[model samples]
Each structure stands twice: as C-alpha cells, then as structure tokens.
Target chain A: DAGVTQSPTHLIKTRGQQVTLRCSPKSGHDTVSWYQQALGQGPQFIFQYYEEEERQRGNFPDRFSGHQFPNYSSELNVNALLLGDSALYLCASSPGGWNEKLFFGSGTQLSVL
Target chain B: DQQVKQNSPSLSVQEGRISILNCDYTNSMFDYFLWYKKYPAEGPTFLISISSIKDKNEDGRFTVFLNKSAKHLSLHIVPSQPGDSAVYFCAATYNTDKLIFGTGTRLQVFP
Candidate 1:
C-alpha cells in the first residue's frame, strides 16, 4: 500500500507571505496530525485533525491552522510566516482508535526568506 | 522546557558492536515511549516502542528498555551496521494525545 504522501516537497517564500502545504495520509488511516521540525530539533506537534475537526493542538500560535478533507487528505496553512517558520512540516496519520504508532510522510520543506 | 531529553547529540561505534541510545523524560504521566530513526530529507521512521506496563520490548535485533521509576528509556541495536547510522529520536505520549519528542541523537556506525 502507498504510504503517507505530501505535496510540494520543497517550498520557498518571503516573510509575511502565507504558505499552504498538503498531505495525503496512508491508505487506511483516518486521523491526521501535523508537526514542525526545526533545525537540530525533533518534530513538535502542531495539531491533530479527526473527523474534519481539530481534536488537539500544541502550543503553536493562531497563525498555524489546518484542514482535513473527507478523503483523509490534509492541508496545513501558516499565515504571516516568519523566518523561524522555515522548517520541515511533517504529516502523520494513525488508525484512529487505540493505535499508538503513526505513519509519517516525507514532509514538506518550507523555507521562509 | 523540553519534556523529553536526549543528552547525547552523537554516538559512534564500530560495526558488529552494540549501540545504546539513552533518553529521559520529565513527565511522569507519559506511559507510551517510542524510538524513531531519520535519514536526511526524510521523516522519522518508527523503530520500536514500549508501554509503561512492560519494562522491555524486543523486535528482531532492536530492543527497547523502559525504566518507569527513573523516567528513562533506551534503545539497543546489536551488531550495528553502517546503514544503521542515522539520527534517533525518543518520543512519549500520555493517553492518545500528541507525542513529545526529544532533540535526537545521531549515531554513526563505522566498519
């Protein structure tokens, strides 16, 4: 089966510009989660989407938001981007029950200039 | 503050030797712990995991040991190979919430 897939593998934008990254979860997963991986740091949770609604969110600011389609694809939107926003954006999906492991996409590399 | 910490930023070992990576967490509520390995330009790949109910879990040549009382966990890779060299991260979760990850440790296995 095809694993989680993310589009626009790499992106570059100027500060104050908005960016949208897309993700298609694994074949059978229903829950989608987003994470930010800064240089030298591990991935940090941004938020999770289940049933088209944001179920849990991390300490990120309001500038970060996301949407999940009925087909289980997801989009992460970052408004008023800053230089610090330049990082790898990862999209992960789980089976949506008591499953603990997550299938992750290669991630979208966002570069803010 | 970081709830999970991997003090060692890098580790090097000869091939066919054991590689031990350590991780510590400050959150006592964390019950599920996992290890992930990542190559450049790739997302973290799940390696192994352990729950609070068990102190050890093994899968093939990879093993994870959890010390709940000390809030520490470790990953052991036996007879390490050069291809095993990569950045390893430790993560934990409470219930079904978001996973908190450590900084990561880069392991280099030399032949």
Candidate 2:
C-alpha cells in the first residue's frame, strides 16, 4: 500500500519553457490536488481533480493546469514559467466525495533558472 | 487577502516540554481546519484536524483546539520529541473543497 508518488523529484527549466510533473495517487484514492510551496512558505492550492475532471481551482493563472487520468494518476503542466515559478510542487491524493485525509507525495522541486 | 494566518514564524522548545502552535482565520465560513507537518525537501503530512462542530480533537500527543468565536485554532504537542521538529502549516476549508493555507510555523525541539 504505497502512498502518493511523484516523478522527477527535481527539475530545472528556463524561463518560458514548459514542464510537466506526474503523480500517482494512493490506492483507493480518487481525488488529486496540486499545491505550490515557495521557500519558507506553506503550500497554496493550485487545483483539484476528480472523476477525470477539474472540480475546483485556486487563484493561479492559466499557465498552471492539471489533468487526472482514469487510473487516478495526475499530471501538472506549467507553461511560460517564470523565476517565481521555482518552488516545490506538491501532489496530494484523497478519497473523493468528502473530507477524507489527504496523502501527499514527496513533491517535485522545480527551479526555473 | 490571506484567510488563514500563522503569525509565529518559529518556535523553540526543549525536549519533554510542551509546544503550542497557534493559527487564525478571517473567514467565518471556514468549517474545517487542518494542521500539516513538513520537513525540508518533503511535502507536508497531515497531523491533525478539527471541524467547526467540535471545539477540540485529540490524537495521542497531538491535540487541536478550535475556538469558533475567536476564529482561532491551536495545536498542542505534549512532551515534544526531537522528531517533532518541523514546519507546521494551518489550513482552512469552506463549503467549497479547496483549502487555503497559512504561512507556516517552524518548530525546533531541542534535546
């Protein structure tokens, strides 16, 4: 029973480049959420996906988007990245429908240089 | 506007002592509150949570107390251990599913 898993633990991209991070939800989980954590700050919600569709979104711009596959895995895509985009992108999974506990992955550390 | 806030940037406590981390929210609509613990280079892990219907919730050494009247909440760790040292974040959620997080409080448990 592995918990949420994320790929490309660390990445480096230049300004204006696009990057995609991946996440596999925990077994039996159907909802996936994305968050961004800057250095010395807590995470800010980016969006959430359920039933292969985006159910809720935060105050992020269009440059940040995500998708959830039928297998409950997710991908976060960021386009036209900026230096401020350099942060830890976290993926959390939970059981859909209610206030289930969220299981988080180690996260992908993106450094826009 | 920041809905949730953890004003304390850091807290230091000796081992075997108690640690109390505080949080406040400006939104009265927030119905659920959660606390998460994070270490460097890792994502946050859920530590505890409380719903607005309850004033307090406890699990082992960790306890979360919510004061709806004051729009405040606090996490108390009794007999703190070195492993408890980490950055703590307070998050709130309204009827909508999305969660809003605070700036976080770094806790240092000295042995």
Query: A-chain TM-score per prediction?
Result: 0.97, 0.97
User: Model 1 clash pairs?
Assistant: none
Predicted structure with the largest DockQ when compared to the true one: 1
True-vs-predicted CA distance for residue A81, candidate 1, Å: 0.7
**lDDT tens readout by residue for model 1, A1-112:** 9999998999999999999999998888899999999999999999999888898999999999999999989999999999999999999988773336888899999999
TM-score of chain A of 2: 0.97
For A1-113, candidate 2 gives per-residue lDDT tens digits of 99999999999999999999999998999999999988877788898999999888888999999999989899999999999999999999989644335788999999999
After superposition on all CA atoms, how large is the RMSD of candidate 2? 1.1
Q: What is the C-alpha lDDT of each candidate?
A: 0.93, 0.92
Model 1 C-alpha lDDT per residue in residues B1-111, reported as the tens digit of each score: 999999999999999999999999999999899999999878888999999999999998899999989999999999899999999999999986789999999999999
